[model samples]
Target: MSRAEQPSRRTVLAAVAATAVAAPAVAGGAAPAVAAPGGSSASGATGESGSRRRRPAGQVDHRAWASFRDWRSGTAQGTRAVPGRRPGIAIAAPAGTLDYTDPHTGTTAPWEYAVWTSPVHRLAVPATEVIASWNAETPAGTWIQVELRGTYSDGTDTPWYVMGRWAAGDQDIRRTSVDGQGDGRSSVWTDTFAIDDAATGLRLVACRLRLTLHRRPGTGATPVVRRLGAMGSDIPDRFTVPASVPRLARELVVPRYSQEIHKGRYPEYDNGGEAWCSPTSSQMIIEYWGGRLTEEQLAWVDPSYDDPQVCHAARYTFDHEYAGCGNWPFNAAYAATFRGLQSVVTRLGSLTDLERLIAAGIPVITSQSFLEEELTGAGYGTSGHLMTVIGFTADGDVIANDPASPGNEAVRRVYRRREWENIWLRTKRYNASGKVVSGTGGVCYLYFPAHPSLRQRLALAAVGVR
Candidate 1:
């Protein structure tokens, strides 16, 4: 069915109030006891002989705040002020230009594109995914295309792979179009793109990257690229996790939304809902933190559409090169564009690490692949997909907002801990010849308020987050 003809589903209200629970002890050390807002201890522990416990004079309550606060402000021990880690590496682009002449007008215009090449980055451990992120400001006649090349240990270099061409609105370099006449006017956009064998069949060992910004000069507005960078990781060939670790929290209630219901709604934005898991997951978290697109921002969307913000997200995060919204770092960069929030793309070692983030009131968006049988109740399987890890069950099962669901009501579902772990952390698949191939490994995008509490920082630090 054509996207414009797709049926719109009713918006289901799924906001649930979050409740506080005792902070789990980390690494076998008891977390310092803190008082609840009422000056009472919130340890949830009973006194000796089963008597009701009394608050000690010095106890400070860390669990009272529903939202995270600056940890350095209070007397919380083990807390030191530290800067939040921004994900991805920065690429240095030398100056370059592309000049185009209009066939009809016989007028020539010039566009400047920054060229960035990375130093020899040796992936001693070959990774399955190579990802890039950047922010750009361009007028109607400008766009950006990114390419990559890599050198193997045997001294072979992979051909330059086109990561993507990004611009506002619909004009994409992948298509034959007039110079600089893509979608929308001057606007600032942040995007990300990824390359993997499953999609591109292009793999490399140690690598370098190239970025080009295209523009047609007659337009007065000059194109500007704020920053660009790439990242890669090696995922394990088998699915295995540590025996056990501390359970951080009982439950966290993240707002739920579904992408499947909106499938085929906007083909220009990568066929809308069917390919919008990343943006849909991002929208849920954005609203969770009180961020929303203003009406002016939604003006470009179809007036009759339901939840137009999801469409806005898809458009903002879309990549002309890869042609989808599943880029990990792009979604993170998009989420970070909002005020009072910070996001990064990184890998988590285990479910326990995920538990800590949830315990700190942060929801994580993760990438994974699975067979239909591997993840029960998913109804469908994908070679690549994105979902939000909202919370966990008492027994450590996963509670996620899987946008792949057919309806919003089915978005919030649970999966067995081990089963979910295998699909999420394990990125190896066997080919027809029974040979193992690498997959996008335990990668995730973590979004949280800019000022995390002491506990949140500790959780992030434990996972070796940069």
Candidate 2:
């Protein structure tokens, strides 16, 4: 479908304006409750410590990019292979061709791709992860592959790195999953490739990305790409906090959804339910604001599934290269593709800052590593996992839509606020067996509707949300 003809899949809900109200601080806390304009105040008492408080909204440092080339302007170099093909950043004749064989199915079909060398993006701020993300749709045998390289301060570029090939149910670039012709169909998918210096042996000081889209020749299925971009962040390995820090709010309420309930329903998408935390969390917030996939949009999914959109989300966000849908920027980028929404990946400094976002009605998807004992009631543990920060409890505990739960009804549960903070904000954690597990300090994905209020804008600005 053409950009103008793409179906609207969800009902539009009015954006909630932030409310400003003074929240009472804990008896000996150092930081006062600073609510965003129009943001709601938390009913719980705030915590205090001599640690540095969160920076004012405007002073926080972060960065995000929505697209690599101007699609509407045709600035990106590529052919308009088919009529009704969206104008910008599409693959066509000359640069892209349709004569390639599907690696998974061996089916030949018409295929095309566009290549762009992005303007040098400077990562002046030290960053640990370079995330390459894009939005696109391809037919049964088509797919997208993204590669990235970094320019260091010395003006040297690293070797091109394959981010991933986003085809149906493909594995990570290293090919860990069993390869196959996945649920032969076409759908928009978003994915991210993380660049860590420790693994790549290159300092990601500055960078650029290369994208290639492919399809089976003569099939007549045209690949549609709407947006492509990259995000870089230097989240610390560990967060430092004083011995005692107070809570930020009494309670805030966000919606809930679980991934465990759908386990084994769609193995093609990362063995089905076990690997869908990212998309499940994304779906909860999307539905919270009245967003949903229409029956037509989800028609590709098997009807036996209960929440087809979750299945759709898993397939749409599946990273052929990574073999998982939990790519950070990809999840945020996927949320951005929906009408009325925008998203970005950044790190929060403290729970105090997180409370500010919750107060402003924005739910946060956070990455953490924890042992079962470290996080009580979670029922399971992981080396790395994602969960939604929907609200805080009366005692400042965390209320979230933990998809790891066995069922949807049990998705919303509270964790000890401080313990949750340690797992969330601090990077170092222990696994269930008390083995030391390093972390990605305070990294989170923030998504919300566009045209935010001033305070909402401030909250977004603090996280470098564009």
Number of the top-ranking candidate, with lDDT as the measure: 2
Candidate 1 structure quality by residue, lDDT tens digits, 322-431: 45676565566567555555566667767887888888777888887666677888776565678998888877788898888877778898888887887777656542
Model 2: how far residue 251 lies from native, Å: 5.6
Tens-digit lDDT track for model 2 on 1-466?
Answer: 2111211110000001001011110011111122222322111111121111223242123332233223332234553423232222445543656454445556554555556444455554534455565555443544666666666544565666665555432321221212221111101122322332233333456666666665555555544554455655555445444323545564445556678777887797778877788899887776665565666667777787787778877876665545577766556655755545556666777787787788877888888766667788887666667888887766777888788887888988888877788877665554444444456567788776544666676665555554
Q: By TM-score, who's the top model here?
A: 2
Give residue 66's lDDT in candidate 1 (0 to 100): 11
- RMSD, one per candidate, in order: 16.4, 14.9
Error of 2 at 39 (Å): 16
Ten-residue region with minimum lDDT total, candidate 1: 10-19
